[model samples]
Target: MTEVAKPGVLPARPHFSSGPCAKPPGYDPAKLATDVLGRSHRSKLGKARLQYSIDLMRELLNLPDTHRIGIVPGSDTGAFEMAMWTMLGARPVTTLAWESFGEGWVTDAAKQLKLDPTVIKADYGQLPDLTTVDWSNDVLFTWNGTTSGVRVPNGDWIPADREGLSFADSTSAVFAYDLPWDKIDVATFSWQKVLGGEGGHGVLILGPRAVERLETYTPAWPLPKVFRLVSKGKLAEGVFKGETINTPSMLAVEDAIFALEWGKSIGGAAGLQARSDANAAALNRIVEARSWLGHLAIDEASRSKTSVCLTVEGADEALIKKIASLLEAEHAAYDIAGYRDAPAGLRIWCGATVDVADIEALGPWLDWAYASAKVAA
Candidate 1:
């Protein structure tokens, strides 16, 4: 490990890449390995660590007894696909796509499942009208659009007692915001987002309604071993326990446990929310002060506190990319560019791993980048 030193400089501000963010301040890689990685996941010690992880997650989220949490395959994407493949055929599907990842899932539903999907799309900065949705149909949506930095305000509009299931991809919103669980049947998130854990694994949570859907309705297509939610119409017990369906990266598990423990130490969800809130508030102040910078999300309430997307006034794609390139080269920021397929601008991940002080540092860098871009153009 290399040490960073400068006479007047504070410690390196946390890197704010959208995913796989910089580890928290004072993260000890060696300690995490020793504390979480010595045993096979199947051994008694492994099981105890896994159980502790689950219990801590439940306590942090205040989950109900009826809900079940599982460490599943792949990242959040894997957990989401499993739910879509297993529990989706009961009713007509209503999918929402406001950003890249949401659109990716919609594509999977169209191509992989070959299901006729009714996709509701919004431009990069906007959200689809919830009033326009049909509550009678099963719904799939990203509660927080990670790429676009927009989020659904609340689940309040999701008809209280709808007939169909609600599958939400809450990867970026889980710890940083209040998720009204009653409105969702299945929710998925990866530890890498807010938790700053290792990647390649996903946490899948199922509400009682989703479990019933799994038991009552099997898809017309054959299920693969990894995606299978049930054996003989009963949900797998190992899923909720430490027993994963396949071999998992024990190191990644340890990293997740470490992040979760850190979350608990900082006051759990409330602390995480404060971190995000402070970062967002700091960035919003910057955005408001600048004439050229404006948020991507149109509605104030729906704007995400985790990933804060900003756009330059009348800037073209090439200019936006140029500015992003400058920031990366300077090491003032990284992964702050907008998604390639979306309208171009700056995108900042303001999750819990990111510090308010780091975001404050970013404001001047952004102003400098914007001015340089305008001059070059």
Candidate 2:
């Protein structure tokens, strides 16, 4: 295949951004406008689509009846902040910082809320030692670190029964990995990651315990209308029923509905999991075949199946940049460079939207890029 030079143009397959990932194979944008556009979100049609999305997600994830899912404002970060600001302060909070996203939550607790927090910190590619923590405390963690491509192996490490709640930011982990709902109290995700939908909408799932906390304990800081989960000291029942706390983007909601429905049509969560697993396996094969490139994730078990982060072994920054530019100029990839804050390398989004065949095609290009790199180096 000829490599062409065009900024922002993606490979025929379009499989790379970490979030707002490539849309599902064969997605028809026109169908969205005809079916979802020109309709009021509060109308029966919109409500049905919204309600169906919630039901499908619950069924696919096997969520318990005791749990409630809400389509909320902002993306995963916004959903997480709503949970943190609304549910913390009544208890001692423990924040785990292993990657950039984890550090963000710690900052929210320390600087924004000014809550006295016990933070556990680990360098990139490592997990915070959970064994050292006190279990009788509310805890927060990011299940997958998109920037570092490191993930928590299991919720098995969390105490079986803690007096306080466990909150998770599963933006990059959902659908690609197993999340132990039993071990989590409040979990947040965005539509754009694994689902490959439009952004601006966040999903928040709260366990019964989380709801109890919301009703029984209000934060010391006043809540804004956008962040309000509890209205006048009462848990917002309507939010869980497709009634958003604020004006929501019906277009985004409709996109989420289509994505959720698409997820169901392809064998639901299992299909999404398999797609991610296959993409990751294909990348692993590439790493094994090529000596110059390898995963930045130290351990195979800890590596993310969704966002595959790889470092060009023994290559300098300039060489890595050259290879990345080569890939981009060819329109073979988009946003494949490693995150700015992380060490230089390539980060491939292997979420459900990415096909294994595309990864296979891209594998040789990695080798070609490296050969070009050796000449440049």
Candidate 3:
């Protein structure tokens, strides 16, 4: 391998983590100074801020008025668990697992909940056959597989008149991809993913059908206070009206409000999606020019624009880790290693919070890192 000169420029902010991703450009901790700390979340001021966050999210996502958006206690995991616990027993379930998180859901269904769900699975870098899904059975799947970097191309496979509800774990897909709200009955996302906000909070969106399921159907399993969505045979309206099940992180709520405002300033959902698309396109160009580096997602249609996974030809896990360490040590990138269970490679976050210029700067650093790793090997 020939020695390559170190790149002169670096990404302005070297945070490329998949979760708790890079904060929005110009993010300052002091901006959250006005957070209603040490105060009751039910206080007028605190409630107003919380309501503002919900309103902003609804506006940005173009959610229908009939949908109920609630700020739940746990992050995406908590929100997803709540949905599964509350809704899965009402009908037979079909779970599609392709990666770590999706597999986790399948485990929950088959072992924990003992729902005995029909499981459809695919290996890493590929998606399960959507055509084979039984929509008559309540379906659960991740919108984008963060570990494998593959996403469902569209919602065309979901029938309009289907009897079952669709629960989508869209933690990594929101803001970066277009979600077919008409097809999704329950959707969950975390503040830390594409929004570049603080963690410890999950946003759960329930369509009218989901709400009806909650009110009309009762699960056989025990319900924790945190997981309960209906009370007295009726939907808990206060939860959707900014009244949380438990005390929330006021600081995180403020940070989420700031991120949402920033999202709106950039032209709401359309602008955020465009930014992520451009970042992925920038990196995709580099991958196309290099024969060694290829996308972990084999199908271009299923490749994720947010968590962009790449595989280096003839590279082992150690080699991939070495390349990632080289980039981090040089301050060119951070947190670019693939998920532990994923194929040996790199995973770069191309969410809206990541600038296209930074992704462009990363190309040269990756080349240098690969060469350096090869020399060391």
Candidate 4:
């Protein structure tokens, strides 16, 4: 094949990282000028701002009143670990892992926590058999497998009257996917994923059932202060009310507020979902037209709209890296390389914050990179 010429068009923004995704459209650092940087997070104004962020998230997610939303220390990992340590020992546990992040949680449960959890797993681009999941045991799974670009098609497989809690690591799913809240007992996400906000903060949402578990059940293991969501056999109501377990970055909180506001201004969660869907669809068109590229997800229904992973035909790891580097060097894309542990390919962020036009612009760059890579190889 002949080398393709560099395209004249370029993505308006070259950021396509799955984490710390592209900033919200029209984002300006000046928007965060009002951040309460030097003020105590517990001060009246600070507390109100924190509460506003919680309320806004609740509103955008359309969470039921029975659910409690809180800001927790650490990113999604912290929020997830907090739930695992606090709740798993109360019952037998099952974990599902399809990608690196999910595998990390499985390791935490079986190795660190020593819960001896029953783990159901799949390779990089596939989903475990949802029908085979033992729901009677406390279940932990990622709603979207960030590295694999595979997502659970829906929550239909989860029984409504199941005997155990459902803990969902939804860091890369929220804002871009519609979550069946009633089916999820505990859910966690980071600010840097779908919302394009700063990192170092995690949002934890507990359904009434999860709160009940926290109030009534204590794990067999010791609980760290940071992971303690309950006190003296009672739920830590203050935590749910924005009294963080530790000091939080007010600057990140302000950026989160800004992102949430931007989400709302663009028609809330539905609008965000639509934006991500459009971006993915735009890219899919290019992938469909090109014989050399395809989605990593084997099942179309399971494909992710947020982190769109791609595999190039007959390409090795080195070539994939070369293609990514070429695109990066040309400033046509950044951080579009696949996860190290995942199969060699490309991972593009088509989340809400990224413009569809940028994704469209990326198609030609991908073509050029692939052609250049093939010639070099």
- Clash statistics: count for each candidate: 0, 0, 0, 0
> lDDT tens digits, residues 1-377, model 4?
78788999999998999998999988898978474789998999888889999999998898989899989989999999998989888888999999999999899999998989999999999998999988889999999999999999999999999989999999999999889999999999999999999989888999998988988887888888999998788898988887999999988998999999999999999999999999999989999999999999979899999999999988889998999899999899999989999999999999999998899899899989999998999
Task: State residue 105's C-alpha deviation in candidate 4, in Å.
Answer: 1.4
Off by over 4 Å in 3: 33-35
Comparing 1 with 3 on lDDT, the higher-scoring candidate is: 3
TM per candidate comes to: 0.94, 0.93, 0.98, 0.98
* Local distance difference test, each candidate: 0.84, 0.83, 0.92, 0.92
Model 1 shows how many backbone clashes? 0
Q: How good is model 1 by TM-score?
A: 0.94
lDDT of 1 by residue, 251-324 (tens): 88778878888888899889988998998999999899988899999798989998888888988898888888
Q: Rank order by lDDT, top first?
A: 3, 4, 1, 2
Give the range of the ten consecutive residues with the poorest summed lDDT in model 2.
1-10
lDDT score for residue 139 of model 3:
97
**Predicted structure 2, TM vs. truth:** 0.93
Q: What is the model-wide C-alpha lDDT for candidate 4?
A: 0.92
